[model samples]
Target: MSAAGIGELREGPLHAAVKDLLAVPGDRAEVRVEGFVIDLVRADGELVEIQTGGFSPLGRKLDALLDGNRMRIVFPVPAERRIIRIDDHGEVLSARRSPLKGSALDVFDRLVSFPSLIAHPNLVVEVLLCKEDHVRAPEAGRSRSGRRRRDPGERRLVEVLDSVTLDSPQACGALLPEALGAGAEAEGFTTRELAAALGVRMILAQRIAYCLRAMEVLEDAGRRGRAPLHRRA
Candidate 1:
């Protein structure tokens, strides 16, 4: 469901910060269009949406808005994160740089929610690689892994490291590893090969393959044992 108004839309620090940075001088923020509240409507009539969460919730909103309008979905992936622990009184306890790194290809993880949307002529999926601070508050107990529990207090954007815009199926292909190649002369690759090439997990590679296949950028090239092979369509 669409938010009743801009004020009613719940956003964390990171999401709000990104929205403010993306807004242009001539753009209108929190605009109501066709019964949905658009994040930003440019002076030239382009719709911009900054989504810090999953894309599944945007399925209906995009379906309703994509017709006869240009829409850009801005998704931020934390290229680097600093973990900050906070005390009960909101005082900082400790801060450390997380070892995990994110890549532009991470967008495929979320794109799997609405893979076919990549084919829409009016839709542009913009992946913003950002450096961020992840603030956490201590929690009482931990049962699952017997580790200290922490709650997500806030996420603050530090800097926008880079951005990649997927405006067409070919643009989506750019997310694929260079080893994967493209066009009719392209070679087929399995999820294991994709994972190795991208330095990501097999699950993420699988999701990327799934999204690319749905976008028609990758087609079935037969199977390698239990795993499926994919090549450029």
Candidate 2:
């Protein structure tokens, strides 16, 4: 098979590198299974996929494979990012550290799009924490404000930092910020309370609740004033 896209999806440099780093001696790369081009099929028959972006795109693969196969979806999160600007000739113009620091909890932000996937026993989502270089090149024109435009170029993995795997509902629930307390004491948190506990905006807290609820880790406990309360299931 070619080093082409998996199931017609193109692979970026970062995607390819992560796969190479994660593959073991007995693993098979770019194998076709059930009409899907899986990233890796372990010797033990577990399917592994590397997704460098959002979870929404895994819909088809999950729908088809999660029924009978143990599939692991690896999502790479740039825990530390360095922005590299390149000129027309691909020579580096400048490089700087990005101010945005990512947390493992960021997996919840993306999981909001496919919250219920965690409920699938055969599916495991692994958040691969990595240091990355985000390369960019000049675009055709400048903005209305006279600032130069840059294309969103490919990302290159600098180093593998750590990883967090979510294979069960309990694992998903453990991602909750510790400020919410633990176990029984963490129950009855409204979105407002969840937001405060998580130190995030109300919208993100709502998304977190939606994901946790779909995973069956959190259940409706009743209402506190206007906000609905949730408790550990």
Clash counts for the predictions, in order: 0, 0
Question: Which window of 10 residues has the lowest lDDT sum in candidate 2?
Answer: 1-10
Best by lDDT: 1
Model 1 pairs in collision: none
> What TM-score, to 2 decimals, does candidate 2 have?
0.85
TM-score of 1: 0.91
Task: Encode model 2's per-residue lDDT on 118-202: one tens digit a residue.
Answer: 8778989999888999999855598899987768888899998999989887898888865564666465878887878766778
lDDT of each: 0.85, 0.84
Write model 1 residue lDDT over 1-233, tens digit each, in one string. 43535534677789889988998789988888897788889999999888888889888888898987999999999999999988889899899999999988889888999898788889999999999999988665886989867586688999999999998888988777665655433656778888887899989989988998998988998887887788878
- TM-scores across all candidates? 0.91, 0.85
lDDT of 2: 0.84
lDDT of 1 at 110: 89
